[model samples]
Target: MNNLPIGFYVDNLYCFPVGPSGSQRFCYLPTTPRIEVLGNEVKARILNSDDAAVLALQIVWEADTDTIEKAKSEIKNRYPELSFINLSLADFRGVTATLNINKNDKVIYSIGPINTSGPDMFRAAFQDTLKSAEKEAVLNAFNTGESGVITIVYDGYLKLNEIADAEFDGDLATEIKALAPREVEEKGKGFFSKKHKILTPSPSLQECKDAVGKAIENKSLIIQHKDSANVSKKAKDTVIQEIINDISQCVFTKIEEVGKNSQYISSYCCRIKKTKAESVKFNLKKSYDLVGTISESRGRDIIEK
Candidate 1:
């Protein structure tokens, strides 16, 4: 009987350099072939340790098992950073690859090594991998037709770009006034009085209003749902409250209230604010977020910087 057409499995691939600085010699570690091929199952192990850079990857396939061994072998030889050991074939359903890395280590899988060369090359390679993975994910999702709602909390502060684009309430007004400058005047001999001047258009207030209004207008629940009225009133209430909480938590990062339009600042701020706001909007509208984040920025410092 012919050996089952099995894919290749690489146990561990490692790269370490030797010789003097700037004239270093490097090659794969001396060890058992870290790669293995089993009927439909391929496995490999790899390690990346470089003074300046390192990478480790394990590639596997679910189709065309017969070509996996050849494919892996070719790839390994071309990329010295890769290693293939324990050449064997067996009966299995899938292949596996693993890399040993520190908790803080960042790993990237690319068609080629990233060098002093501009990210252009790396980006192209990265894109190919991403496209492949994305295609697979989208296909899987489409085939499974599985989706649901997810609720996310967003909280942060933003500066006013223009004024009055979004409505403002007392709570919002208070937060804005707290961040403004105060004027001092002398009253005769030793007595002095201070008056507070409203220097900028407070967009935070409007942000709150816009955020809440948007949720209401879209009939979106902060808690997240998939176009379902099956949600209990309590759940619905929770979602609304969470939306409010997120808006209220936002702090104005920058205030550009000088333009005659007054709205210019508010509009500009909203655009930037969307990074975090969009997540809330997504949860409210689609019942789930395919992308986005809700964490608030540290403060206005990031914006001003």
Candidate 2:
């Protein structure tokens, strides 16, 4: 029978007791990976090599070595705290002897660095060793435990798709062109001087929705004209208005929580477009106030909300 199965090797180097800290408050100190556990030690799972390094640093910021060496030491110090029973390549002796193994053979472990430049140089070397020892048919031989030279080869590939259909047709294009803006004469600067208006702040979310419903009911212009093609540009403008109306009709709920306090606010806007929606979401909670302006062209206005 094989001496080892599908399980990880564990080593405990150091540990300490901690209290009252968030995210598991315990501190253990060990210089190396495999120190014997004492009877009065804290309870935790084993740590994988990478996790061991991380945990060691979490417990104490400094390790007694440079990058790679520090990583190894940290791993050694905390390997016993991990829960998974993965076999360690470091613990296995014949791991170096038989480098040939099938990729699908269900090897007990995978080993790699925290980061690698380009392809991992260590993994590349390891793969080369496996190819040399296995020869070919690595997977089949590994699955059956057959006594023969095995070879494993893996091919990587990618796929792409080309666009086939265009959604904008002749009618849609003609309508869209009609919606383009035409310049009009500028308004007199003193036009609003006689009328003094109070700048009231926007209402809460519920009030905003009620106001939007009232405005839409009053406009009576939600539907686009089918025969608007005679005035192609006008028809396109109507379509754009329809799109804005559809967007404004959709309601979004907002909830904000601060420490022990929580509040819900609902709001709506009349002029909703793709660009405006993006800007609103991007600047949310920062700029809550809105303003409006009229266009020189007839029946054209821009509202920022």
Candidate 3:
């Protein structure tokens, strides 16, 4: 198996020097013999011209499982041809390679000195770095205009046997659940069933008073209400009376039923006199629940010089 071409294997492990400051170096045997470096750590692809086979490698630094899964879903949806493969450090044992940075800079990169502290110390760091690179590559392909044609190699250092034992944090699970799409049930209602329109809640007395005050300050008032055909005439008169009592200076300049009978009620367009007083004060605490009977009820200042 080791003698096969690099593309024959689903994954290949290769290491390049981090820097000259690191210590401890050695190479062990790979489970399979085919090894190749297709590109820089950001993006690469192993290929066998004779076999017409290729395997893509993408590096990202993300550790969150949700993000990785989402990226995988997006990539699969967009490309559909490539598969994502996550790699861990344990997949490859002792491996050594000589890399030439430039004409003058040559360095030896190794994986596994089983008896030494180097592999243990660098394993976590290497895993994190690889994960980061994979995440970057995945995001670049998805978010930008780049083609989503690569199969991301997940962190290979993770032991295959231990994968089943790994678990995501509870918060991450909760977040994923929250983000997942919820199914909305479709209800079959009888033709005569009471169909209710979603209406905004009625304003409290304090809120109404504040609106009046604002209208007074702006020198105008425009009261808008949907036609409440369901509400009795007495109730509509009561609401209009309450408004008049609260703002004594304001007069109903116009009232019209504009829409068809399907409209719940007629709309009211009222004009109020602008008072020079610093504030308009009113102490009516009665609750009208106006919006409860109608779909829309709002008061605004329609400035008129």
Candidate 4:
């Protein structure tokens, strides 16, 4: 079994708690991978040597020196066909090892160092790093037309610290409760969120009269003929008169011919006598269609002209 390709191994030398007070320390030396339980400081069975180094770190964090030594001894006795080197996290320097199974079989191992403050932090960082390394290694092996399993092993011990619960004073808690609830700002969907204005079609003639009356009171009116090919001079003059009769005041400007397709159209710029602000106060119902028709007929380019 030892002659078969094993997994990757990473070794690190870090301080370990040795005594009851958890202060007595030593440089942890992990030779074989093992399983350990947290808090209870229990060393479980030795894991297969092919296990990942990050996994070993989990067990190693909870393991004591004697347990680790015994596990190492057992591995040596059980798998004499396999050979491994003792590496420390402190001395880690991108070392790689290869296990020779037979004339045809070989497994490669990449080792590295992890700098962490405590077992909890180490566990999180080690898990992320190991996952990345495993992915990379598998991809590399596949690219080389090779098949192999990735095993990570880390040798080191991290001191476990008891996390304290947070406490709040009675006055502070009361103050917090007295604070007003924060209002959540509505966020737009950025480029995806759009306010589309659904324009109503032109209103009926009666509706147009009402809207024109209101619009003239507040807003200036600008009317321009758009359909040069279809609209006649009589139609234009009739429309302008209809508007003038409905509005309180109307001023008809000079007609200007536009368009190059032998299509002549006139523009009638008129203004309401009321101030812009007062004109806005006029509320007319069902005037949207008339306004829409006026705006659309003028065409967007008409503003520039």
Best by TM-score: 1
Cα lDDT of model 1 by residue, 103-219, tens digit:
122222223222211211111111121233333332232234322111111111111111111122222333334433333443444347554444343455557456545654664
Per-candidate Cα RMSD to the true structure, in Å, reads 27.3, 29.5, 33.4, 37.2
Better of 1 and 4 by TM-score: 1
Q: Candidate 1, which segments miss by more than 4 Å at Cα? A: 1-227, 252-264, 268-305
Model 4 earns a TM-score of 0.17
The C-alpha lDDT values of all candidates are 0.27, 0.24, 0.26, 0.29
Candidates, ranked, lDDT? 4, 1, 3, 2
Question: Which digits, one per residue and each the tens of the lDDT, describe model 3 over residues 152-260?
Answer: 1111221111000111111112211222233344434887666454433333344444555465356454333322112334544454445544443221111011112
For candidate 4, lDDT tens digit of each residue in 188-291?
Answer: 56877755433222223444345454543554444433222212345445555554453322111111111121122233333322101100011111100111
Model 2: per-residue Cα lDDT at residue 302: 12
Candidate 2 residue spans exceeding 4 A from truth: 1-105, 109-205, 211-305
**lDDT (C-alpha) at residue 184 in model 2:** 38
lDDT value for candidate 4? 0.29
Error of 1 at 134 (Å): 67
Residues 1-305 of candidate 2: C-alpha lDDT, one tens digit per residue? 11211122223222221211111222222222111123633111222231121111001111222333443444445545533222111211111111223335443322221221111111112222123222233322323434322221211111111111111111112211222223334544695745443322223444434443454456532322222101234434544544534433332121111211111222222333221110000110110000001112210111001
**Backbone clashes, candidate 1:** 34
Each candidate structure's TM-score, on Cα atoms with residue i matched to residue i, is: 0.18, 0.16, 0.14, 0.17
